[model samples]
Target: MATTVRRAVLTLPAAPLGPENPLPPLAAPGDVHRPAVPRARDGEELPPAMARRMTWAPLRSLLPVRRRDAYGRHRQRTDLDALVVENDRLRATVLPGLGGRVHSLFHKPSGRELLYSNPVFQPAGFALNGAWFSGGIEWNIGATGHTTLSVAPLHAARVPAPDGGEMLRLWEWERLRDLPFQVDLWLPDGSDFLYVGVRVRNPHHHTAPVYWWSNTAVPEAPGSRVLAPATGAFHFGYERALRRVPVPVWDGADRTYPLNGQRPADYFYDLPDGERRWIASLDAHGHGLAQTSTDLLTGRKLFLWGSGPSGRRWQEWLTEPGTGGYAEIQAGLAPTQLEHVPLHPGGEFAWLEAYGPLAADPARVHGEDWAAACAEAAGRLEAALPRATVDAAYAAWRPYADHEPKETLAAGSGWGALEVERGRLELPGTPFAEGTLGEEQRPWRELLRHGVLREEGPEPGPSLVSAPWRELLESAGPGPYTAYHLGVAQWHAGDRSQAVRSWEQALRYGCAWPALRCLGAADRLDGHPERAADRYAAAVAEARHARVAHPTATALAREAVEALLEAGRAEEADALLAGVHPTARSHGRFRLLRARVLLARGDAAAARAVFDEGFDVDDLREGERALEDVWFAVAERLVAGDGPVTEEVRDRARAEHPLPVRYDFRMGA
Candidate 1:
């Protein structure tokens, strides 16, 4: 019933960037050569401020774009390599051109993808800093959550295996955490499994927090549930609530399905004990895919959003959600998702996880037999683990000698959701829920990165960051990034004139249009539309050469277009739109701009036509249709207006998009 795949390493053209791939790079082009993470020598400690910030789960917060320290992937499609390696049973397409992510994994026997194959390698609103894409196994390193370089290109090669098969290998040096990470994936000539090996190094003198998870994607249907050897699970909610629940079945519903009506997204921190190493997802027919490991250290997790309107929107935004939206069957280094995995200076952590197919009667699924089947498959994969990674995992596990085999775990016993209190045990609430998110508690990186930078802005709040971060930004010389950050801090500290001067200094240091963009914003806020228009025009020209693959192009274009229109330069706005990449044009923000430009030109019919063509918000939680509805509401109301359209448009914009929301919580960006 499946196509017979050929075992060949065919180098293909670059994967085409789609509508979802429209993020402007946070940094300038040709930045792949930026300095690597400082090799942490033995005894070298991370700055206390940065060390304290490492434990934070990175949040997708909106912050001022500080791109000088950023690295951008700027090579056009022609400059990259796309390699496809396949055997009779499996096939994988690796895009060395794009962060070396395995673009697709197919099961030839069933002709189905065992991993979530994203239709578009697009950038969207994810990550605490920079951009993020969904699908495949994105390697997250550095200060946990989304690594800065996760979406950027890395060093990659295609090497022939001894058996005449091929392997695609990738490695990158993470600058923020001062570490290096490598991944090697292979599909054996005659095997049904895809083998993967990952190695991460601290290479520093002091202990540093490390968080790495291979986020494997799979199709999610009504009955699709992740099957792993666990009786209990920890869940992180969309609102950031932590819940400990019985696995498979929680409360009265099957926890595997997207049936948690109140919860929009479900993140299960699997309770993998020492022995169980395989996790699979069973569909309504009890057949899907599974990934396994021989080592006890590779923990499993199941993360999917609700099947509500909002969740459906995300599916369409990130990939083709309607055909069969995807979910994640993630594997991590430890039992808890929030645990700060530490790597000693010069320490390296290596492990392996294998992928294979699964088929069984639905009766066996939802029953104890499913667990047995998983264990059997896991046993079969023991031979597949690379000897080196297996040895390393064993060496790493031996020190934690007290862990019992997962087979002995029970729903009501062990570390089963016992919320750890101050040396006390209470299962009711998380430390975050208890209003006591101490400095000692893991900081959400979103807060850690800019919580302090945003402090002295427009509002008053007790300082969450009582540190010298400000001093460093101000006194760290006039490097472009430092100057930019210093500007932000000064602006937030209520010194607008000084912020302008610092931003000008950043421009002199080659920071380019981000400096201009900030300057334009300050000019506009100070009631100088002409000055703002001048800066926006310069930014528009600086962004001209940026194409679809350039990360900064779309964002810079958007800001410039809006500022041009606001400055009564509608024709100039229209002309400037020509330079924006077509991928960004597919977004609602760009569509809105086009419509506004038309309306300004008195071409009412054309504006309405453009609005009806399908406006879309790029955020995952809302699809194109939501923007269509907002457009209809605005357009219909304006047909009878004699004056300009109402301010309700911006309010409606807030409802339909994430960008309108303040960068900070409940306040300003």
Candidate 2:
């Protein structure tokens, strides 16, 4: 019954995570929720402390957007590399190549899968950079959205555990925050619980905003209740507001059951200062999973996709149509996902989390009294796995945190190796060796070592915008290539004027259409939509004339059409879209754009027909309502005659043209 760690392969039907978008993510996709709460709402307001530390603004920068939208919906049987850590009582399956996600945790005695084990490896548009799938225990770091490493590989290795058994260690330098982090997972020789040790290190000389959330997905079932040690919670819904509401029941429904509401929502439980932080999801039979962590991880949240059509549709879209729904019970360093904790210079945050089964009294867990229900689950959790044991585990794991990895298991991005080489980082156990550096880091290495950025290909492969990289780019002499990168760095640093100047200079120096597209993004951000459209159109024309790759041409055309439509030039948008490659025309994104143009040009029938044709944007983002909005907009135009469509017309359109399930990917109420 000894613990063992070994490498294995998981063959699932997986959609290939296509190449990263070559374009610099000059503009954020603008999908994050920055909820603005009202001062007066029946004596409800965000706690003053929560409101003050809510944003990581002035420090948060998303400069190098490595777009992962190139993945298509076609999933083939694929062999995913994995690492398995198992003991007598439980087995943990980790996907080393996929952000070090814990793909499955199986309890041997009960023959139960504690985590929501996704049946397939489908990449959806959920991550901050794109391409995210539902289910599993996902480690989210680097700002408010899903981590940029959602589907990216992480360096995995075998390390010695405190228990004398080998532990699986996963480490990577988070690009967004420019910090190194590691996760060590081990199961003791004779334990039902799987232990995880997480550490995020800010090796920089200045303060860095650090966000970490261990998101666990559990199967959603009838009578399932999420129990936490808090009565009141901060509720955030699609209305884009955070309101303090009572737990268990709010807005005349018992929301802890996951299926009680008709919309997707988050309940960030307000845990007491000294309370043992833990959360559990118990099913109808009173048997379920519980997660507990050291005091360093304070936040607990319940994210549910309720029984509404939109929520159901989103659930189906994330996986197969007939799969059971799941809800996320998460723990983070901050009280809510909206906040980011500041890790001081040369500081680190570490914690230990344990996951296993808990069998509680069903009647008490489902009772009317919220306190009694929580106490019931909490008591059972304590009896099963005491808080002191978790603390001791953390203490034991800390010393081994710096132990050199015994054997390499997988490879991650070489950005860390590049950073380590540039900065002379002395990290011990989590090494970013020079051998990990690849083609992506070549130009940066050249700039770092030789002081000049070399032109790699037709387009710049990626972007680096952190202050250090910016300093390096700034030091690199002024050329078309250097200027383009400097523009991106300047833009991320909030130097809009200088960024624009640099981009313009790059274009003048014969830089490719990337500069023009970046300029287009800047114009849109500066509130000149028409100017943005012009820049985008110009970029598209230049790309075609230059005989750029068909994908690049299509990408440029997509941006142009979007900007043109946003500028209220539907005819121009349609004309521009029509001239793109046939693959672009058939793309789900373009089809939706065409529908928008048809509605704008006063052709509701044509717009509706596009919906009937049925297309899927493989990378349709989480919480994106563009498709649903357009469908209803076209419906309103079809139902309402001439003048402005009033509320009455809107209601009629909703009733008459109910959103088709195929297109209902709305994440809100």
lDDT of 1 by residue, 149-223 (tens): 545656554444424444555665454444556665666556677766677766445776677766677877777
Off by over 4 Å in 2: 29-31, 38-45, 58-61, 640-648
Q: Which 10 successive residues of model 2 have the least lDDT summed?
A: 32-41
All candidates: TM-score: 0.58, 0.96
Query: Which residue pairs come into collision in candidate 2?
Result: none
* TM value for model 1: 0.58
Error in Å for residue 435 of model 2: 0.8
- Candidate 2 lDDT by residue in tens digits, 1-669: 656899899999888787777677776555445565433145565666666667455233455657787888778999989999999999999998899999999999999999999998888888888889888999999888689899999999999999999899999999888999999999988888999999999989999888899999999988999999998888887767777888878889998999997899889999999999999999998889999999999999999999998898888877887899999999999898888788999999999999999999999999998899999999999998899999998999999999999899999989999989988999988999899999888988999989998875567678888888899888887789899999999998889999999999999988868899999988987899999998998888878777877667777787788899889999999899889778758879888988999998999999899989889877788778888789889989988867689999999999999987788777775
lDDT of each: 0.54, 0.87
